[model samples]
Target: MARIYTPAQFGGYAAIVSCAAVIASVSSLRLDSAIPVVPADDVSAISRLALILPVIVAPLALGAVALLPEEINQLKSSFADGAWLAIAIVAIMQGVTAVTNSLCTRRGDFVLAAFVKVVQPAAFAGIAWLLVRDLSVALATSWIVALLVGTRAFRGLGLVSGWRDSIDACRRAWRYPVFFAPVSLLDTLTQALPLLAIVSIFGTAGGGNYSQVQRLIGAPLMLVGLAVGQVFLKHAGDLIRASTPLTPLFLRVFRNLVILACLTVVVIVFVGDWALAVFLGHGWRTDTMFLILVILPVVFRTIVSPMSSVFLLYGRIGLVALWQVSYFVVTALAVFLGRSGASLDYLLATLVCSEFMMYLTYFLLAYFLVRRVDRYQLGLK
Candidate 1:
């Protein structure tokens, strides 16, 4: 991607991706989340809701984006001329793929789930590697086509057999639409803010640089975290439904994540620049400063993000929502203060500090919730 497309082009690609992610977060109304928690008989209804909701919701998300002309333009720049619809299509695809992914996760089909994650990026990079021209448009269309990535997970499932059941499922899972969707959306927004802020402050090229920084130093480890999150959500959710203690499971995850984080930081600190130069270019390589503030928060986020499902399992939506609101406010304020000072270092520093602190608090809160559940479970035993 780096060799074929310039930083500016890559930034546009990243921007479009971030926008699609925001739309996808709420597109299924987060009904995919309920698949593991709900009764077996009800899964089909939820699957139907997952398929239909994205159609209804993705347009609304795109329409709302249309109201923000600049945001629309950022997305537009990523596609070929006369291909503006690619944005909405890709967003809908992302939402649909998310639900299918949830389906795969629910069934312990981790191999397929992992394969689905690889196909898009591999396809995008392969296409870009073949044709350097119209790089952004090619990438956009690749993602648009990737909506089919997880369709295998839907084969035995009934997505449209009973419309009435879908409605009933929607009614039953009203809390997900009302509460979980917004929290999930807020989480996506939080993840995307730094790139957006950098682009706003710097330019698309800077956004590209920041995006690659994440791809290089953060993404691989975070991919591991995400894969772990799927397993954690499944198993921890099982613990909840079975009325089993979860603190031990939570702590084991926490400990392993910490060790993995340390290993990631060590590797990145030692050979990060080499990997950056290899993947992007020597010109885009980082220095010591990047090793400290930038990498710290990346590792911090890895530890906290996966375990967050524990909160949802325990019905602690209020606390999760509060943490999300606080994270956005604090991070946005950092953006505001740094933009005012006109110092990228200050912005990055404040951003990293704020995120590290926020993630730590999130981990502690999740731990406390699980421990409380542990006490109750022991008393029952």
Candidate 2:
């Protein structure tokens, strides 16, 4: 796709997808997070809540994006020629896919959840291969189709019915958005800003390169992290409900993730350059390889993936919110500093530093909180 399309065109596609991701994250209203924690009887209602909220929120989000000035969109490498319609479609689909996937995971249907994760990239790759002549349409169509397919897969799961129950579910869990929505918005912004900054500072070509490397490297991490995190959260919730000690399970998960992360880093260090050349074509081999190397240190912190669910289990939303805000500030500052006469390498280095700092902060905070909670519970016991 990178070879088929100009960097600006690819960057435009990336910007649209990134914007859709942010919108979807906001419209989800964090109802998905509550799916596993909420009572079994309320699961269907919560699923309905998830479906209803996005229908109400996505159009407003689309309107807001449509209202942005053309020049601003151009600077961000976004599509300004009515492509917002495609973006709107993708955003709504993404929100529905997220909720349905969460419903599957909460139902202990890990196979379905994992299949949903696999569908997007597989569909995108297949479509891009088939439509090599038109990368933009291929990319947009891939997302729309993949999300629609994934969402529809949940049809018999009883997630999308019962309007009255959905409204009641919304009323019961209204506070969910209070803590999570803002944090989710901030987190999405934090993730998307770096790509936008790359476009603004280094032009669309830079943004394209950055986005490619992000997809290449981040995809595996996302798949593994999400699968493990879902299972961990489900088990953690069960154990918490049973009043069992969580420290042992947390430690075991942490250890396994550490082993996996270490193995991944070792593989990347040795074969990463070769893999990039073989898989992504020769054009991506150099800069992408170097960027991968630069960010390898940050990959170590991926061991803390399960800690997120730990926070949710303990209802430490305040801590999670604080960490997210702090991370956004740190990442924004890094981007600002990188804009000051820095090369792409330097900018990437700053990103690595920012990611390392954020993950380190999270690990420390989660560690302390987990220990504190364990102690309190032990005292009560």
Per-model CA lDDT versus the true structure: 0.78, 0.74
Summarize candidate 1's per-residue lDDT along 11-113 as a digit string, tens digits. 7667767777778789888998888777777788788778877888988988877677765445444444533455677777788888778888789999988
Q: Which ten residues in a row have the lowest lDDT in candidate 2?
A: 282-291
**Best-matching candidate per lDDT:** 1
Candidate 1 residue pairs in clash (backbone atoms < 3 Å): none
Worst 10 residues of 1 by lDDT: 75-84
Let me know the TM-score candidate 2 reaches against the reference structure. Answer: 0.90
Model 2 stretches astray by more than 4 angstroms: 6-8, 70-82, 151-161, 285-289, 297-301
Error of 1 at 126 (Å): 0.3
* Per-residue lDDT of model 2, residues 288-341, tens digit only: 346574445346445775567788778888888999999899989998887875
C-alpha root-mean-square deviation, each candidate? 2.4, 2.6
